[model samples]
Target: MVKQERAARTRRALIQAAAEVFAEVGFVPASLGAISKRAGVSNGALHFHFASKAMLAEAIETEAAETVRRLTEAARARHGDSLQAVVDATHDLMGTLAKDIVVRGGFELAGDIARRTKSPLRKEWQRWIEDSLRRAGHSGELADQVPWADAARVIVAATVGLAVLGVKDATWLSRQNVTRFWELLLPRLTGRRDTGTLVSAGSRPPAAVPAPARSPRTPPAH
Candidate 1:
């Protein structure tokens, strides 16, 4: 049992270290030795957990994909089929790109021509956006003029563009940037009246809210 726990820890450390290295250097230039050293694990230990750099990259991508899944799920849970869920999720994803090394590395790897086919992170994100848009259409949240496919394309393109640009300029991933994007686009996508209800800055996640705030305290009887 102890050995299993230790192995899990080592594997997690290697994945995180590999993500940091990959985020700093392109996948082609990233080295297992560097990952191992950053992880503070011997090369043998890294090899014991992962056989190759590609495998380690795969681990990073898988972990990143899982994180995105949970983020989208939480957003949907909060907003149901509202387009706001899509907006919130996009904001969360960009925030993740800015601060989460594994997610950033996974996205970068997803764009690498040599290894792009191996990573599903980008494709999965696009699919989720499409699915969310479709749901919004079904819920009558989408504007009459906007087709789900077109909306999905615009959103996916913008978000992916931001992620790519963020590689060189961290400012692209800032919440303000994402919020500004939604502020401009949501009005067009949902029309003027519906747009008023959506929060372009994205809604706060349920978990982030204080427990005491769930129900307001009643003042003493007047």
Candidate 2:
């Protein structure tokens, strides 16, 4: 039992370390040696956990997918004000993307052609957004003039853009940035009655201003 527990810890350490490296340099340039170094584990330990970098990336992708799945599920289960729940959940995910190396690495690595199919986190996010929008429209949370699918497309595309932009400029994930996006979007998307209750961004003080856009001449990492 002790050995099993130790092995689990080693594998988790390697996955986390690999996520950090992969998030920084992407799948092609990342190396097992670099991941092992970051993990504070020996090469032998890394090999014991994962056969190759591809396997490591798959592991990261799986973990990231699970994280998103839980977030979306919890959002949907909120049971009141579906749109507000969706908005809060999206805000939660942006914060997670800002802070979680595994989640960010999964997104970056999943975009790689060389990587094998793992859990499709991006597609999952898209589905969740569309479904949430549909739920809102059905619940009459959206104005009659708004089309759920069309609005969902705009929001999902914008969110994905933010995730990509955030890779270079973390400010893209900032509360103000997200709030500004919602501030502009909510007016168009939500019913006038629902506007006052929905939170556009996190609870962070609105004073910590967002950063300006930066060129992506350097490889992006979150």
Candidate 3:
């Protein structure tokens, strides 16, 4: 049991280290030795956990997909307006991409021409956007002029482009940048009256809320 627990910890550490290295440098150039060094694990330990760097990258992508899944699910649940939820999901996704090296690495890996396959992260995100837009159109949230297919393309392309750009400059993933994106699109996507209700930026997870203020208690008057 103890061995199993330690193996899990080592595997997690190696994955995180590989993510950091991959996010800094492309996968082709990232070395397993560097990952092991960063992970504070020996070469043998790394090999035991992951046979090769490609295996490590696959693990990173899996973990990143799981995180994105949670983001999509929670955003969908709390949002009464499907379009707004998609918009909010973009905000949350960019925030996660900015802070989580694993997610950033996964996205970068998906874009690698050598990989040849669609990224699970990209596909999952695209699926949610399409589903949400379809729901919005069905429920009359989308504006009369808004085309759901074109809207989905714009949303997916813009966010992917932003995520790619963010690889070089994290500012592209900032709340302000994401807000500007929504600011440009919301007017055309939703009725003007509904625009005021949707959050344009920094909409955190449904569970994220500002903490209440604490003040010193006053002594009771005797």
Candidate 4:
């Protein structure tokens, strides 16, 4: 049992270290030695946990996906207002992207055309947005003129763009930035009555917005 716990801890450390390295340098340039060293584990230990850099990157993506899944689920469960749920999720997503190393690395990997791995993180987010908007439309929460698909597309594009732009300027992921986006967009997307009730900045602030996840060039994580 002790050995199992220790192994799990080692794997977690390796994943975290790999995320840091991947975020600092693109996946193509990241080195196993650096990951192992940053993890404070021997090369052999890293090898025991992962066969190659690709495997480590996959682990990071998997962890990041789970984090987003939980985040979205919690957001949906927290708010009865479907639009509010999306607003809350976006705020949390940006929060995590700015604060979680695994998420940052995963998104970086997803955008790397050099890396052939297909990441589901963006798709998952888009699907959730689509579902939320669809629900809002059915419930009369959306404007009669607003098509859920179109709203989903716009939200996806804007969020993805923000994540990409945030790679150079983290300010793009700030809560205020997201709030401003919603402020402008919510009025157009929500029903007249709902618009008055929906908080464009999200129904609630995240519990805490941690320090930057990386030293520099922070983007929203996948």
Candidate 5:
């Protein structure tokens, strides 16, 4: 049992270390030596746990996808019926992508891997997004018009593009702008405009205005 526990901890450390290295140097440029050094483990240990860099990359992709799946599921469970929930969930997903450099980098790596190799993780992510969209009431003729598969593709592609842009120009895709882009585009794709006035990029809606108080009536006092 102790051995198993130690192994699990080592594995976790390696994964965290790999995520950091990949985020910094990218999947292709990052080497096993750097990952092992980051994890404070021997190169042999990394090789023992993961056969090759491709395997490690796959693991990172799996971790990222699982993280997204959990967040999406939780959001749906909390706010499935409301359109705001859908919008909020989408924004939340983007926020996750933006905040976690490893997750963002892993997605780019997964795309590159898909082009060169048979990457099941990439396909899984695509399917998961499509499934989430369908569950969120984006379907039928509207689904046909937008096509959940195509919509998922566009959503992920846009995310990747935005992430790359942000990496190049830190201010290129601010969180506010990302939120607004989704708020505006989602309604068009879902054929639902439940959220009131789309908030502009970098600006939130103004606080609700209070009603004016009525004037007091004059009294006939001596």
Candidate 6:
């Protein structure tokens, strides 16, 4: 049991290290030796866990997908009542990617993986975003008259493009700028104005009550 746990830990470290190196240095320039050194693991250990660089790249993609899934799930749980839940979830999802070097690398690696392997991470991300939009009542004909699926695809594509740009040119596509871009885009997509109110999809009332004041109590004599 202990051995299995240690192996799992080592694998995770290797994945994280590889992701960092890939993000810092583009996949074409990255090396397995660098990844092993970053992870503080022997080359043989890394090979044992991941057969080749291609496999390691795939693992990074899988990790990115899993991260997006978890962030979406958390947003759903936290803001279940609001259509903004989808927006909030998307923000959280992007936030995770922006912070993780692995996710950044995965975006760059995706094209190569698609050409070389049958992995469907990009498609999965698009489907997930589309489903979220549908659930948020942003489906069907809006003012723009564009189909929801098409819009969702555009959003995903734009997001991926921005992410790649951000990785390559951090000065041009900083996290703050990316967030503000999304903030502007979301309202337009949902056909809603930024009213700055907590939109609840459920029947629950908003939490508007003020807290009770504390009574003054006599202090004990010192």
Q: Candidate 3: minimum summed lDDT over ten consecutive residues — where?
A: 213-222
Candidate 5 Cα misplacement greater than 4 A, ranges? 81-83, 113-115, 118-125, 135-153, 164-174, 190-193, 197-222
Which sections of candidate 6 miss by over 4 Å? 80-83, 113-115, 137-146, 170-175, 192-222
Q: List the residue pairs that clash in candidate 6.
A: 81-201
- Model 2 misplacement above 4 A: 79-81, 113-119, 191-193, 202-222
Q: How accurate is candidate 1 locally (lDDT)?
A: 0.81
**RMSD in Å for all candidates:** 10.1, 7.7, 9.6, 5.5, 16.3, 12.4
Ranking by lDDT: 4, 1, 3, 2, 6, 5
Tens-digit per-residue lDDT, 1-222, candidate 5 = 866656666676676678767766667788899988877778887887899987887777777776666655665566554334344444555565656644665656655643376545446555656666665444342333666666667766775566556543545456676776776675666565433433323122322112222222221111
Better of 1 and 6 by lDDT: 1
lDDT of 6 at 77: 76
Error (Å) of candidate 1 at residue 3 is 1.7
- Relative to the unseen true structure, what is the C-alpha lDDT of residue 77 in candidate 2, on a scale of 0 to 100? 65
**Tens-digit per-residue lDDT, 1-222, candidate 1:** 866656766776777788889888878999998988888778888888799999998888887888888888888898888888898888888887877777888888877787746567887898899999998887788889889989999999999999888866789998899999989998888888698788998877423311111112111111
Instruction: Flag clash pairs in model 5.
Output: none
Name the better of 2 and 5 by TM-score: 2
Over 139-216, each residue of candidate 2 has an lDDT whose tens digit, in order, gives 888899999999889988888788877766788888778888888888788756768877777433322112222222
Error of 6 at 16 (Å): 1.2
Worst 10 residues of 1 by lDDT: 210-219
TM-score of each: 0.89, 0.84, 0.88, 0.89, 0.69, 0.72
Write candidate 6's Cα lDDT for 43-100 as tens digits. Answer: 8888889999888988988877776666656666776634455555545544555566
lDDT of 4 by residue, 80-145 (tens): 547888989899888888878788888887788888767887778888888888888888888888
